[model samples]
Target: MSHEARQARLRPTLISFDVFGTLISVRDSSYGAFERILAETGAHRVDVEAFWEHWEHRNIVHYCKPYRTYREICELSLEETFVHFGLTGDGRLINHYFDAFPRFFLYDDVVRTLDRLSRRYRLAVVSNIDDDLLALTPLQREFDLVCTAQRAKGYKPDGALFRYLIEHAGCAKEEILHVGQSQFTDLVGGKPLGLTIAWINRRQLALDDSVPRPDFIFADIQSLNDLVEL
Candidate 1:
């Protein structure tokens, strides 16, 4: 807590962010797409659990086995949900889900805050999405660097992606800060990679003392901008 130490973290040369829950809100866009999908396929009344919990669990398990795009995951999820609820997994419904899936509204403070911080730290996005959409689709303005599973050839919660980034970005382990919402992806995976990670605990999930801890934690992004000065 000395002025001298605070000065050191003032400007990191590089900061990487997780795309989905951290920088963009995919809930409305993704679920809305699924709503249309389920309706067209004559699916049973939408079970919220299918969309949020089961699909997420399924996707992570699927992605780790072999490479897949975020779009592909969405497609498979539609099939899985339909099968679980005993509905027809029609091709038309799957296509509808894919078409609407890419639309995501940015978080409230994303643009201004990123612009403000971009002045000081080189900003990049590291995500498990397909190389193109995951890194590029959501934003019109360019990021300094963007890394994806297609490029990294692997998924997060695996340290390889983060390690490749640090090597490619040409930054030291301690200087780079990673911000993400998933404790599994951002904290546990990023720990061995050696970056100082800030867990964006958006849902206010209780901390598990058992897991590897984050160097910094914020329940919401409101406090994110202040991190450059921490």
Candidate 2:
């Protein structure tokens, strides 16, 4: 069948969201915390760009390994970045990121859009975060199903977390529409399972050539209204 024909036939009963970049506004608070951590640790000479590249890359690497608490993974990734950059920073500096979580807010469009989407579909959040950290954000009250890496004992792009969501949701893969910002995690992990995928390209990033194209692409959560009528 043609791609448009295939999508036209998908009647999603569950709308699953990836938190962080998708629902909550965290980039500023997260990076601000990281910068504060660097200053506090006296890592003044560290290359900011290179440090994030190494740290985030290490996060993906750690996610693929045996499950660890998200905080542990963050600390490990940051500590490794320190070593990779010849710095003496403490892994515990990741606490700054955690401390900033309470300050993170939902995007202006999120609650109104979700409220509308919920009228027609069950809503859920599948995130790569510890449950407590997720609880700190406004999103805690918003989802019907909450699947976190801590509960799954694994992370995304590996499929364990997505599978956990599928099992707990008790629905056929075709009934679920998984929305996320990361091509590597959401598209790479959810597509192979037969779940319909939507790429919320909040950053306006180019779709990576390595992953399969998503069933739909949108600039924000509000675009979900295009998929389902309220």
lDDT of 2 by residue, 1-230 (tens): 56675565446788899997888876755777888878987987676656776888898888889899999999999999888878888899889889988888888889889888888789899999999999887675757888999999999988999999999886887788899988988999889888888899988999989998899999998987767645
Clash statistics: count for each candidate: 0, 0
Stretches of model 1 off by over 4 angstroms after superposition: 1-10, 91-94, 208-210
Q: Residue by residue across 1-230, what tens digits does model 1's lDDT show?
A: 68876675546778888878887776655777667766676664766546546667667766656766667775687577667677776634656544653567787778887887877778888887776565344666678888887788777876767877787787787778788888877776788777888898877899778668898888766576666663
lDDT for 99 in candidate 1 is 60
Output the number of the lDDT-best candidate: 2
The Cα RMSD of model 2 versus the native structure comes to 3.2
